[model samples]
Target: MTDSSRPTRIKVIRKSMKASPDQTESLLWGDCLFCTDAAMTDYDWVLVYDEFPRTPVGTIRNETEPLLCPPDQTILITVEPPSIKIYSRAYTSQFGTVLTTHSIRDLPHPGHTLGRGCLEWLYIKPMQEILDQKEFPKTKMLSTICSAKQHTHTMHKKRYDLTRYLADRLPELDWFGHGIREIENKTVAMDDYKYHLCVENHLEPHHWTEKLSDAFVAMTLPFYAGDPLATECFPQESFIPIPLDNPQKALEIIRKAMEDGEYEKRLPAIREARRLVLEKYNMFAQTAAVIHNHRETGTIRPGAMLKGRHVLRKNPLHALRELTDTLAYKIRSRGRRGTGTGA
Candidate 1:
């Protein structure tokens, strides 16, 4: 969809105070109609409740605040997740029984709908152009930053050791783990390398961590070790998946690619794919599209609501409040103890 067609009259409403660190109060809950300022006048919908409480109101009651433009004028898009427990409370409370949640995979049909969905990470950087300008070398056996935690793993250590053995066998093969100054530095250095080794311990397959994104952003081919579906989620043919069955075989394949210059011939295609992701899969555009779709269709999907349990005890706000109360009690008790000692 063209940028101009996207929703321009968006409004956010929230309780006057800030909510969670990740949530903006204005995006959660507030009254759009209450604002008289011209700058706030053009909003098409109002977001209610920045963060869903642990226990929301039991039912969708009329008394609950509406987060939208007056009745028919604009759409009322409620940002909710797919969890039945959360939705049950939200549906029973203020926003009414009708609700819809969407997933990141679901794009809007018409392209002008209003709603919200999970905005997954999409790294943006001019990797190809930079790589082209720098004229980076093509070398085998490239190792991107290995986190301290991964280095500590017995399996990971064994894999690294095996890779080191392979590197020793081939003199031309070079390994680099110099600390990267920034994303650009990493991207440029990665583009020069024949194959980027992206090994991670995260459970979710096809998940693109920032490091993997760096590979794509820099127009460098990746030998991914996590999530078999990682290639399916992003630009096709941009990455070479490290086989789960035989990771050593995958390394052998990478070794061949390095020696044969197959990695060099595919650079143009990888560069084009990276460009498409940058233009189409941007977080801002994706977020706006989800917001638009939700308002048009009042249905919530599995991923629309907040994921996992909202552990109240571990909450930062709760922890801070508890700490303050404990300190205050200790101070008061100390004063009383001093008074008793004197008496």
Candidate 2:
């Protein structure tokens, strides 16, 4: 909030922008965002939506309210993870198009990959110290890191019940690490585990968050139930896919993998996965690239088009269909105990 760095103007609208005499580079950081240490740098225009995933762009932009930035900026670079359509509509909207003179992009991100964010587990070598003390297990089975209190859907409820079942059904499966923020920092609890149930909020198309990151960093094979795009970084050999609908099937996969030493055998792929996460799938690098692109592109183009983007209003019918499909997913989720589950 220094004088040179401060925004010359400010408002709180999903659409519209107020004019400012100073065309200084501006950055807006949301307080409740998933990317705690998100990339923030000097750019002509930068907008960070902390709750982008929580809020739908089209729904919020119905009214022409003024936003928190200078009016008529060359660009309004947004960084966050939401449905692709949300970003598409935002870029094409009247206000979004105007403010985003250079670019109006909805770059979906998987939480901030900042600061050994997930790599802390491997970086600290908690498991190594335990092994040196002759206290760690020679061969561990499956383990999961549960949050203190939060479940997204009814399927989460059913999964919790199943986790309880397996806790007793197989005592060897160590499902610890709830309400232990200290353990999260050092990877003390995760090391030496052969497999990790890397469940995330949902099985999104391109929304794999820290679930896979943590597992890969710790060199543990992940029982993945998040985005399939995660495989883009690490192949199928690196992690196991868990069926969303059937907890029984997920249980079967884990049990089998651990018994036949398949988890142990996947060490090479696990090592490679860790390399990809650290090198390519880094949050700092990704955000820096977006900002760099903004600096390179200077202004907007003709006929409502941002300098590089062609602005066409999203199809009204398509918007309606997307809304209906979302509602359908929720309704069906309510009908069954084990439907549309996330980790």
Candidate 3:
């Protein structure tokens, strides 16, 4: 007998193959009690972060292993872009429901019923703390923080090339990130600039990362690329679109926006977007909303397991792919270290 009035206890299991730095318990669990282990029987709910199955053994003690979650007690969230095949698997039977930008087969994101596009997870402060802050003192006009890493993905290469072109063309544009320079924090680095260039690695519809949102939180208008459907997720006027195919045009647009005082004009919209980021779009807020809904309705069901796929086991093809990718990544790492640049 669980008390419906009490905050639900949630166990957030990381299922993404990529290793991430540890996040605070409050950021990870929101209003819910943070359950450290799925083995803990006292936990009220389990939230699988990106239910991808391609993971090596003994990595974080096989955290990607599938869980036997009851329909009402499990939730899956996919923050990875659809471009990455590893995170694209539909673990229909593994989790109760999913929270993602794109539709996972016929699975409706439980958070969408509350409000759409609240799937993003980031290191964010409380909403009121963000809203109460005075505007950042801008000392620079336009700048960008981009990595120079080259990858097999066409979009990644394009980003690298575009960054080089922009750096060469705009002498005034301050560039940061790996290869060019490193910053302690992106939001802090962006705060001093009136506008920041932020481009997603992949340009898929409804797929956006912290790139644009980070800029908004820094109160910097973004000269953005990728995610044609960005307006569907954020306030339309919060960012200015720069086409990926045209660096020259992007440069011109950046110049014109700064000249026209676009940052100042869009300041209100940017502030609104930041509020949305902290309040609704963040992982904590979204998880809390889902817990609230489940507490009220008590009708959500766990996903149906596919016969052989429901259990976590080694997939031969996936293993071979992982091996190849690992080798490639090691080679890339060595090369990056040798050159002191991702280029």
Residue-level lDDT of model 2, residues 17-49, one tens digit each, is 223324222323221111111122222333332
TM-score for all predictions?
0.46, 0.53, 0.73
lDDT of 1 by residue, 76-123 (tens): 233332211122221222232122232222212222232222222223
Q: Give lDDT per model, in order.
A: 0.41, 0.45, 0.62
Off by over 4 Å in 3: 15-24, 27-41, 51-61, 64-69, 88-92, 103-132, 295-343
Ranking by TM-score: 3, 2, 1
Top lDDT model: 3
Task: Give candidate 2 regions above 4 Å deviation.
Answer: 1-139, 148-155, 177-186, 292-295, 299-343
**Per-residue alpha-carbon lDDT of model 3 for 206-243, expressed as tens digits?**
66777777777788898889777789767899999997
**Backbone steric clashes in candidate 3, count:** 3
What local lDDT score does residue 157 receive in model 1, on the 0 to 100 scale? Answer: 50
lDDT of 3 at 92: 35
